[model samples]
Target chain A: MVFARARRPRALYLAYYFPPSRASGVYRARATANYLARRDWDVTVFACPMDFLDKVIGSKDEELLGTLDPRIRIERPPLNQYVWQRDARDFGPLRRTFPHTAQKGYAWTQRRLFPEHYASWSFASVRRALALHMRRRFDVVVATGNPFSSFAAAWLFRRITGVPYVLDYRDSWTLNQFTDELARPEGDPVHTWERRVTGGAAEVVFVNEAMRAWHAERHPHAADRMTVVPNAWDADLLDLPPLDLSVPAAPRPIRFTFLGTVTAVQPVEEMLSAFRMVRRHADFSDAELHIHGHLGFFKGADAALRGRLQSDADDGRDSGVRLCGPVPKTEVADVYRESDVLVFLTGGARYVTSGKIFEYMATGRPIVSVHGPGIAAEEVLDGYPLWFNANSLDPSALADTMISAAKAARDLSPEEHLSARRHADTYERDVVLAPFETRLRTLARRSS
Target chain B: MTLVDEAAKDTPGTEGTPPHVVILSYADPVPQRVLAYALYLLRRGVPVDLVTPTAPSSPTSATFPHFRVWEMKSVEERHPVKWLQYTVVHRLPSGVLNRVRRVARRVPGGGPVLRAERLARRTHRRVADLVDRRLFWPVYDHVRPLVLARASRRALASIDFDAVDRVVFTDTPAEHLAWKLAQRHPETVVDGRLDREPYAHLEQIR
Candidate 1:
């Protein structure tokens, strides 16, 4: 009797920012890639060497890297775009002639070129990936973008290979969420390119429905292809031993934790103002806002923003605010466990859903949101128990919200805490990505 | 090219009035080609006002004094959209036009009328206006004359024609504009060369 050989599903995962580099976006990309691999799909991840540069966000958990199925293949292409202090070996003559100017010039070039820098690198990376793909065909291609150039590369690859490509927009392109400026004008070259590429995509995925709707309205013809796959908390991260919730004989200072990069886009001014208001109004003189993140990545130019944040931390120390620096991914749970409240400060008013929000939810602790009202987190945290929602950036309102959340932290019952944890369980990373896996399977089957 | 280059060569700082040249282009840093010419002239103590299109991505108002950029309006004809639609929709009979032109040249009484018709067809006023409207050529037409006038007044007022010896046209677009301006006002026209085209001459001037 002749037996038929079992077929394996093939997928190419194009993520510019992937694991070992602890950028906040890496969690979702890592989880999605692993989840796809686990579901019996042969996954090939294409990323850059530049992703792991600097002490920007250090990697901690090698265990998560180990968890990736051995069947999964990883490919790294040399990225010539970004310049970092860690990359001293490659500096060569650049380090000799104009050491300080080299870094600044590199940054200036990146900003001026914007999407083109990555697009230029994509030419080489895609050529190499395509050569491999021709030998062993990929059934489907999934491209996630923050740089947006990854999507362009995938789009080009799909055009060349005739493979169905899915665009995963971690953040919206064309729409500037912070200032509401059209990122590119109608006749602009980049806008025209985006329209053409998105026009041909098999599917387009966004973090939230608002972003999905925004893209849909712009590309009405491709509206039917849009999908929403939200950022979610890792099951392993949430599976840590339950924290001992019993109040100490004498309560230590109330610790508020923010675990992400602090950049100019972040509403740092509002956060500092709220902290000051809380100190002025509330009797908790010992309260501290612990910021567990680096200031900014871009070198000398970002120094001003970094100095301002440092000064805010210094000024707040008199009133008890501390910038605890960055914690690794492995130690993030410990940071959450120690914190009395999670301070959710984010950039952009609407359509912005930060990956940290899901991790914050899994902590089952009281969260004070100091973000815009119509943000995606507002919707996610709506059903969340022990969440303090401040409608605006008003310091007075934020202070009041913080005070209430602080009080909730002090008066939390075990039963209420368990309910909060249960709510978080639904948004586990595996659970959230399960639908995505099933969708990929369907796409693979159709292609086969 | 040699004459223009020689004219642009700088002399030692001898405290003489500089020749002022106005550029009719984008209202940013004068296009690099124009800027290079301006710099060469500046080294020789010649002042310039680089008038340009008002909607420059990054205006150079503060950076360089000679880089005076601006925008203006002009009257031009407009074409019907139907003519464009016809051009795109139908393929022209390539051999018919060629054969007809040959026949017109050979025929007894057809030569002059055919040549006049051909010239008239090529220089369609409505078509030119349509092109102008679609691609914003009125901006160039209006601004070019103003730039020439301003530069001429500055040159004649401050320095001798001998001292303000050359007005180098950058390249095709600027060179073509310079050609047209030179036809109307010969006094301002200097050495003409298409060598200093900026942005690798991606920009084509009709």
Candidate 2:
């Protein structure tokens, strides 16, 4: 019998917000992990256990977890910063009184002891992971971060294990994308630490071209190592049987659905005003703005903007703006299926490419964007034949755009909607990650 | 001569008495000098009191025996209105002088009003520094009791200026403030950088 050699490559995936946690960042992390595993990679995922219980986002998708490859290993280190009720023994009396504050204090002490709080975990994880690598070495260590702690961990592992690492910046560190303020001042401990860590990283991946360019400007010597990897829709998640628009029982009054956390950063007030103005000035007077997501999540704290949203909802009672609070992620498709128009509300500087935009594209519905001009989302939505762009925040302009987009939605033919869906075909998650896989394999070969 | 020798020469005291030291430090990080000295004195059984700005981020207390670290809020944190005034006046760009001159012409008092404006502008730098120090001294003043209470028993009290010393102070010129503090508190005050070397041994005392 002829021997069949295994084609799979081993890779370590570092994500602090991996599922079954529901942090908004989880979608991209999970998609990356699943995509890599499906491509015959022995993907090992490292995450914090606290993500599940913090309820910053709640867990869904037990079904999705089942779909991950059998060989994919998920290793969770008990995060020192977060205390699950299950890990009560890990805490002291101070932790019980003010958990988040205690966690911060503990993290401060840890950082003082080690260069980074996560370095302690990295030291232990790298030791164990290296042992595995010696038996059958990992081709790549892919670390995605918001904590930026994961990047530090990856840097430590790269030095110790001699494994090449790819630093995926879901958001930029050092350079503030919004205000362009330095996130950490020069000579500050964190700034120095990030400079040192990023200097040695094998490759740096950014979500948008602007972010890549910004990092490249800062680290001119490492310019060639930086790459742009935009977020994309997952084809497997969108493998739902074709939605029939001719069904008689669909919701009336043309539902305008917005799914994701409603935060201060997003122009929630502008969205409410535009919807109200649309009702006042346009023919779609009965159109309802249905918001299906959490207001904000952190220590179960209520955001001041959430209260403002509540007041705006009350103000819009005569108008048809309804704040239908969060729906589970599994039922997200059903929410999308019933909607006539999708509302994309995002905040942050021009470079922010939010994950919701990808899911919106996959829905093949008419999208109305109420944001600043030159935003990365506008670049993604530019070619969609049925897309409605309102590249301004001025209330009257947004109002007019909303009215126009509603008219466009009402007039869409079946053929036009299909064409819009076809445009998004290239952006499927697996297709986006294919080049990243090749990059990792090439780096693995060069190093080995 | 060493700081201890100089202090002994300046103010004669019994050889048996432990040195009394007053330290003025900001409340941000625990002043490294005071911590080293306190650890040194505690090991030597010498009393020490550390006067510092109050901890902005946490609670402070007399945690170590023979060594008490007192925390006080900075003057700026205490006086919000005065701090705002200083911030606005100090940060104003000179390019706005023409704009101010045009506005002054419209006022009831014209050129004399502008002369008074110029005089106020001339003194603004000094006035801002004085206000900052005055408001900030409450934090400074509160720690004095803790210093006196702890070190009063010592036969000779030698102040360590490094505790609250600022090198590049734009608020108040460093030399003027140093000379003023030294003149006012002649008995207890000492030069910070000058006295630093002798205390370097304190790190190894324990």
Candidate 3:
């Protein structure tokens, strides 16, 4: 007599930006997928097409694709590139012949359907999921979104298949995190879509408590299932060496490093101003402020940023500022090691908790925040022994904080370093994700 | 020799080295950010050509040394109807009115003729403005992309598109030109974003 083998519980993850597409939210999606796969669940990811990654965004880190767990399956759904298509040659016959009429039709589709350019992709995702479901049933679905189309796709798939799904809010849909205002005004279809998607979700996950609270106020019915799963530093990517108890205790030029993609929203000008001001002091006379990352995510933004960084004094000959350019993900550990102090430059207040702070804290190095007061990241950095919050964006105040951070970097005690490292240890990818994974497992088992 | 050749001859160091990237800005008021990106490319040892409808008025040739600026108006000039509409329609009437004024001064008791000439010129100006607003502009708005496509094609003839590394669409209007270029050289990288990271990958592959 033959006995049927027990099947592993399956999860279908809908993420518009996944591996090889170097968008900011990919890291969280990658970690979530990898975590699920490791926990003995069969995971499949639905992501954006290669053409969108190659031609539309022109930003891809192929090295990241190699790091994905082999057990996780990835599917690319085609996006109707009517809005993003810059090359006229690729347009359809209708668009080519009657451009104005085609635009009207496209706009009508956006208004009638899911109000996003990726709405077609969401519909395509649902169709793809339904087809796959017919062959072999998926126990649960998990969708992470910036395109929020994925959330709508999951909702559609659940309605059709009666499958339970989780909504991972890597970003906000209606609330503008930067200005703390409504991203879309009243009567916008996006508000309706968000309401329906949240109302139906089996579980809703947010990156921080502030975001969770904001969404909970709007979605009180789903508030019980809503949980905060803060973004944690990936151990596999960093591969940081065991912390050394012995301090360097050497008198040398401090390397104040700011490592991340520089964007317009960040206080880059203020950071530069503070760095230059600190350089005038006797203790920081030879200190160098090294900016190591891509200038901006958007094409042509780097030029404006570079122009902004250009100094008036003899083209910054003696400014002690260095543009170290972008370091690959694999080599990021070395950058963290070489830095004496880390500059946590970011934008957004209460609702924003940047992913870089985890990596910065994990290094056990002194961190100096250059953002506005009351940033949600302060919640994580609250108890970190070496954290030096400027508390304001004023350049003079930030310069004073930088001086203190530099002193701490040079004379930090081994006990304090170990304490900071221990604080960061709690936020490790596996550590922070353990509860979320258990919840998924329980949901899958209950559904089965 | 084409305008590209003349531009290369003017810049001594860039005679043989063709532009690695072509940036198209089809809007009248080109964004300063786009110009900054072009400047950034030049600083990074990358050759650049800027094609635009209206060049910046800040002495860009002196500021952005070795940068090539190809005016889209030059292409519009090649079309006789557009030339008549742009140059002759506005200028010829004004010049004739001025000449009538000059001749009227030489004639004895020419006040009535001068008044009549002024009235005729005013009527002509009003009629010309009405025609341009109602007919010419609306037609041009629809046909501008097609005309600019030809201008971009003409501009590309000077450069080796096969060797060109990137074709960036700086704004919405430039998408038409980008589409045309993509059709001709499907293998080339035609994109909207002029990101520096992808070129690093290209360099690695090389």
Candidate 4:
């Protein structure tokens, strides 16, 4: 009897911000691709080209390129740099000849077609996927977005090739995560695309239960197909030290670290105010607030964010609020190890569950939340032994929480730290990705 | 104290010629802000040349040190069409009409007749203004970048392009001039950001 060898399921992953492009969403995209590849799936990722990462966004982490799974095939479809190009000398012939008309045409296309500056990338992504699909059929298409254009590309690929596609909401598109309202009004191009794309997707994945429920209520027909695959800390990337009771904790000048991209949406003003208030208190008088990450996603945003961090009264030295510039992923574990307490500063109240929270919890240090109450991340932090929630944005209230967190950092039992680490263990990248991988496998099998 | 005095105080002992920065600000409605940037470069020991569509209306009496203003309007007016529009169509006609009206004012029993003629001419001028704004200006503005780019070469003849280390663009209209400058002098750094400190870049080059 002759037996046929089983063919590995192929996944065409459309993630514009993938490994090497150190955008906040890139971690989740990287983890997903790596996990799928590890689980015996032939993963092919369509990501942003190098020029877009290196020149346009100007936030590339070369260290992250090495972290990607070797089995996964990566393709970077070219993007139209017309809108982002700053130098007039770099302008194309069409834009150079008729600048106003060209701008108007691009604006018109965005208004009518896909409604994103990265919309051209989506068309190119679809073309590349289709060409690849013709040579060797893909069993499934999985796409994540902020350039929610990737969802449109996945939907288009499904329409043309009849492949099952999953839409992963690493960040919300039509809904404003911060405001918890519709980002676009009714009948906007974004809303229209969201409807059509959600209607066609085989499965819709959200980072948190709040976001999942929000979309489920809006997309009732597709509710059954929706699932929550919470963002997890990369175990491969982060080497968190085990909680040790043998050595006594350091007593003075506790480090309160916030590890993530500093965006305008974050309650930075309140966080700073609380830190300043904490410094005034005798118990945490010498506490330092070290913000270790890129100041906004783009290079241009650094100066503005730096200005905000540096007040005239305090040039960061007197206040002990140090702006530690971005550290590579490999060096992140060192930042975590050196810090006594972690500051969970996020923007969105109900819907946002930051990936940094998982990494923060994994450190086994006391985690202080500096955001508004009822954040979806609180769902994960609920069982954490060392978790400290401010419960409000008022500086006084947040200051009190920071003091409590600092004390916890000094006095919390090794047992308590271990328990917190255990809570984080469930959110290790592979553990969180396992169920999602099974779902992808099932989808791929159904297509086969 | 004057900006020149401040520049002199800031850079007391510069050994050699500093980096020459040319600022192109054809569309900056406020020339004062461009002056501020020029002042910043001057204070940092860098010489600045400002190219604008028009001269600053309210410059201080105190002469600014290591600074020069090159008005492109002078070059733009040298264009045949613009020259005709300014000297012949608008200036000569209006001047001749005003002279004729002054002579008519001296004539006996010419008061009411002159008033009627003045009212008719005012109405005709209003129509002409409307035509210039509505019909002619859009096409003129569309072709203005190319014309300004051509004019910039002639306008900026005094400044040594080879010695110019930086070409700063204040706005979109200035981009045409920057683009032309970039083509001719590829080595000169062209940056749109005015907030940047020129000294930082100078340090990097050093």
For every candidate, what is the interface RMSD in angstroms?
26.3, 27.5, 10.5, 8.0
> Least lDDT summed over 10 consecutive residues: which range in candidate 4 chain B?
B1-10
Second chain TM-score, each model: 0.35, 0.38, 0.71, 0.72
Tens digits of lDDT, candidate 2, B83-143: 4544554556333555677789998768887886687667765765775577644443433
Best by lDDT: 3
Say which docking band candidate 3 falls in.
incorrect
Candidate 4 lDDT over B75-153, as tens digits, reads: 8878776776556446766776787788889999888868877886787688668767886666666656677777887
Question: Candidate 2 at residue B149, lDDT?
Answer: 29
Which pairs clash in model 2? B20-B156, B20-B157, B20-B158, B24-B163, B24-B164, B53-B72, B54-B71, B54-B72, B54-B73, B75-B136
Give the DockQ (C-alpha) for candidate 1: 0.01
lDDT for residue A5 in candidate 1, whole number 0-100 = 73
Highest DockQ: give the candidate number: 4
Off by more than 4 A, model 1 = A50-67, A82-115, A246-250, A299-302, A312-317, B1-206
lDDT of 1 by residue, B160-188 (tens): 33433235543223433344444444555
Model 4 chain A worst lDDT run, 10 consecutive residues: A309-318
Displacement of residue A260 (Cα, Å) in model 3 is: 1.3
Off by over 4 Å in 3: A1-3, A245-251, A312-316, B1-206
Against the reference, the lDDT scores of all candidates come to: 0.66, 0.64, 0.83, 0.82
Best by TM-score: 4
lDDT of 2 by residue, A1-448 (tens): 9989955778898887676665677777888887777777789988766544453333343555655666778887655544222222333444433333454566775566444545545555666677678888787888887767677777887877777888999987777766667876777677766666678888999988888888788887678889988899876665544446565544468778898877767888888888877777647778888888766654333336556666655443455766676676567788888787889888876678888898888888888887776777777887988677777888788878777777777777677778888878767887788898788878867766
Interface Cα RMSD for candidate 4? 8.0
Local accuracy of candidate 3 as per-residue lDDT tens digits, A1-448: 9989878899999989998987888889999899999988899999999989887777788889989999999999889999877555777765554454566678999989889999899899999999999999999999997889899999999999989999999999999999999999988999999989999999999999999999999989899989999999999998877557474545669989999988889988899899988998898889998888877875446667775665433563667778777788888999998899999999989899999999999999999999999989999999999999889999999999999999998887778888899999999999999999999888888777
Q: B115 in model 2: Cα distance from truth in Å?
A: 52
TM-score of every model? 0.64, 0.64, 0.75, 0.85
- What ranges in model 4 sit over 4 Å off? A96-98, A185-187, A249-252, A281-283, A312-318, B1-19, B28-47, B56-67, B74-142, B199-206
Task: Please write out the lDDT profile of model 4 over residues A1-448, one tens digit for every residue.
Answer: 9889799999999999997898888899999999899889999999999988887888789999999889999999988886777766776775565554566678898888888888899999999988999999999999998889999999999899899999999999988889988898897878778888999999999999999999999988789989999999888899877967678865669999999999988888899899989999887888898989888998678666776777533543577887888898889999998898899998988998888999988889999999989989999999988988879999999999999999888887878889989998999989999988998899999998
